[model samples]
Target: MKLARIYNVQFGKRIVTVKPDWLRVKAPQWERVGNVKEILRDLTLNTVCEEASCPNIGECFKAGTATFLIMGPACTRACPYCDIDFEKKPKALDPTEPARLAEAVRRLKLNHVVITSVNRDDLPDGGASQFIRCVEAVRTISPQTTIEVLIPDLCGHWEALELIVQGQPEVLNHNTETVPRLYRRVRPQGNYERTMELLQRSRQIAPWIYTKSGIMVGLGETNEEVRQVMRDLRAVDCDILTIGQYLQPSQKHLKVDDFITPEQFAAWKAFGEELGFLQVVSSPLTRSSYHAEEVRGLMERYPRQKVIN
Candidate 1:
């Protein structure tokens, strides 16, 4: 099998081997990044930006925005493609976390916030209660801020999903991660059917809360397979979608099978929009929570009235 060549570009004195020119992220203002990091540290908060080794961390932190990672910096599942630490017996849930997260939001004075957690399969509610707590805490401190929870599948605990939906966040996101054909090798513990069911149930339970999911390319998936995943998401009435290129975190993790070009990402964006997604953010550097604040505009554009039961 022929492997794709990694491209190297010299930056002043340093030569870095990045996948493509399109993947290059500009250096962010470190002073601003440090300010955000200092706030997070002072509040004892964790963010997915740092835990996942996301390439856009500089951009996000510098912009004074971050995806608050509650429940832990340690995930229960050991998905090979992910960079988050895997711990079988992580620490007990911190009761102070929610308030601290809210403090961070207040200090940041953000108009929108994204809160996500590691897979806490060890917990009975799959950390759904924690999500509710965080959402409520943020609302208490920053009522003007819209909340988006990028959550786990809850190990198929429908009741827990109901509790979260009842919290009434502005958006509920559970990433499909990859095409169905790649689920076994890519996600291992993740079930494609369950992902679809979770998104479908979120829509059914709370049509007012936007349903969002994301997938990564350059992982040996065919274009048609990616398109089919979009179709599946739309069938479940998922409202927002994000598509991005997968970069190998380290040699220990999954190797990048290909480098998806900018043109390909643009094509996927167009296809997702045509499929009736209220918003489609597709680019080589796009992540599930990248520019997540934009959802505030989406909520205004497509306002959903809460259903009275």
Candidate 2:
């Protein structure tokens, strides 16, 4: 059930379809977009929406929701696929960041907030303390708001991971952005097994907290490879899965091998659910935290009693 649109581009001698019609997103309204921009500007907060150039920024902003990016905007890892600035030595963690983020949440009147940060490899805790502080501050300022933390792997730092699980966010997401074979090139700092370990161990530590992960297609991965990754995720008891089409940020980044069709995205959703994922959000436009707030509510409706951590 895709829309009627065809995208063809001339790379050199070949005309390639980079994006299909269904992948074309509607323009975001100015008023709602400006309101979100003004709030983040006034509060001095960063959002992954603007940082990552998310396609749904307008729609999400119009709906009065945003995924807040905390810590500094600079990342330690220089993943070519990523657009976040690389800093071998990013600035020291901001003590006031947590409170400021809480203030933004209070003003936005958000019911759910997704707090993500750049990789702070230099820190002893891998920036887990900042995440905890932000969560606590938000609870203090707006207890009604549920929290989700989109975290990095912390380079397999179990102690850091322990602090985060203990913080008890509604969702803990660490994306395995590509397949194992491609990890050497796409995510050289990341390990597929370690990513699995993070999700599996989180469930063990806080069984009540939902574990989630996401991956991008169109990076020279086969359909079978994608399914295998889903199987690996399920083995770790990951509760949620998100699959999306990968768009290259620049010419220096990896080229899009193919644009996955809407039909294929829908099929993956069905297959992942069949394999035991509690829920799956799959589409060309899906990202790690796409429609994050609504996804929480959908899962919460069929409540599972969680063991108090």
Candidate 3:
């Protein structure tokens, strides 16, 4: 299938660049940097930032924060927008992963930690057990630390969802990368309705847990289409929403439709707040976990802030 050309907005005389300022902050204390690397090396674990080429790595690491990717680096699904390598077959699951993740958190002395994994459809439970184990491990090691998970759809496996929810993470997040019409082109194997179902069911399964979803613009989607996605998420009672500009990962991947202007992002943030999302981060460089610490603070003080359908 041929890709659609992005619509360029012709303004009066000035040409607006779609690229936003790259977000970066200084790394945290020198002592903490060595601590983070030591734990990662000890556990033989990988991080999503390095694996996916995330733009927030510099700032996050400087803040002494990191999101660990469990269940190995190879992904079963070949999503076009993602930079992670896709392997037809993957290595065996490491039973030691949970303990090592927990140890890493303890070593870093993180007040909050984010854990996510690649799609492991090859496993019987879709690596849900590994997620639970990691959460438990973190909780056991650092009882005061807040744990957040950015999860997969589990191929519509409720049993698997239950396993992760049962671990009792503070936040549960999943991304709806683009509008429904573009799903087939961008996330071909992912279903829009199923993604909604997963978010909706998460609320039903764990009413107290904060539920969140995210999207990326510049995917050849229209402004009206972005608004529609926000409404769909609100209908499912999604508590938090993140809107960001999509960056092309490689020459083999999709090209940028158009660089979204920063002003446009600010406008969208206002629109989302008006739509009743408790929290909305609409910036050109914002990713799903960009303001994770702030989100955790809001959710803690206003536990009932999240509206459930």
Candidate 4:
């Protein structure tokens, strides 16, 4: 029996219908969304938005924004909710990927950039060095851009985490994805404690860099569970938090527990802010990289004010 059928899922008073017309206008500002696709194809690079079937891809790319996936498209882990290809033996790490990525960023003229990767548990350093190379390449090629990274847990390897932090990205993000109760269902190989530790250690190693994490609601998690996740993030001194509705990529993936209302998303955003997060983007359309420019603006403005005052 499906959970929704068995239980009367109360979505509460804030359910929002998908407004396609509004989405087209309010989406990201990719000047040439179609052109960008061709460039990515030419470089043979992959994007998480495409691979994961993220709902915000159209708006993000149309707005001239993208989250670049480095390492390779094939992942070693078969997380229940992910659509990334899973195979026993993956292709070798592309040595030229960093340079190609740098060129792509240069062409896009992106002010804020995001880089993420599939889980490469097969590698010795868990592909941390590769991530560092990509960060450095982006820095060298796009000096004016602010870079953000959404990294894997690296299976609790602090050495790998250290390498990524040393690269000096403006933001270091690793999604907790879901609450502890739903980990087995949503992210079976992930450890909730380790995920928290990754954020905690990121601050300890790179105190100046902003630490961020995101969670998806509507996976059968209760309101209290969401609150607890926020508290846990605050405990780690995470600077940013993003909450979005969970839409199942395909029928094979985990089912959508429920569709959270827009009002509920607003309530969670308010709750997160009160908990001491510097910035929170919570909505059905919110993704980790959504409104990335706003985050950079807040980070920049706060420091300048502190220095001036």
Which one is best on lDDT? 1
Model 2 weakest lDDT span, ten residues long: 1-10
Q: Candidate 3 on 13-123: residue-level lDDT in tens?
A: 643333434333344465655666666887798898778888777667766788898886999999999988885467888888888888888877788888999999888
lDDT of each model, Cα atoms only?
A: 0.91, 0.87, 0.83, 0.84
Candidate 1's C-alpha lDDT? 0.91
Error of 3 at 176 (Å): 0.7
Weakest ten-residue segment in model 3 by summed lDDT: 15-24
On the 0 to 100 scale, the lDDT of residue 104 in model 4 is 89
1-309 in candidate 4: lDDT tens per residue? Answer: 111222333357533333322123345455577878988999888998898878778777887788999886889999877788886567899999999998889988889889999999999988999999998999999999988999999999999999888888888999999999989878989999999999999998877888899998877999999899999999999999999877666657777667777778889989998999999999877888887767677786656221111
Assess the local accuracy of residue 291 in candidate 2 as a C-alpha lDDT between 0 and 100.
Answer: 84
TM-score of each: 0.95, 0.93, 0.88, 0.89
Candidate 2 Cα errors over 4 Å, as ranges:
1-18, 87-89
User: Candidate 1 on 96-169: residue-level lDDT in tens?
Assistant: 99999999999998988999999999899999999999999999999999999999999999999999999999
When superposed on Cα atoms, how far off is each prediction in RMSD? 3.2, 2.8, 5.8, 5.7
Question: Which pairs of residues have clashing backbones in candidate 2?
Answer: none
Writing each residue's lDDT as its tens digit, candidate 2 over 1-309 gives: 223244668989765556677677999898988998998998889998888778788889998899988877888888878877785468888898899999989988998899999888889989999999999999999999988999999989999999998888888998989989999989988889999999999988888888889999888888889999999999999989999988877666777777888898999999998998888999999988888887557656757576663
Candidate 4's error at 33, in angstroms?
1.6
Task: Give the Å error, residue 16, model 1.
Answer: 9.0
**Candidate 4: Cα lDDT at 59:** 75
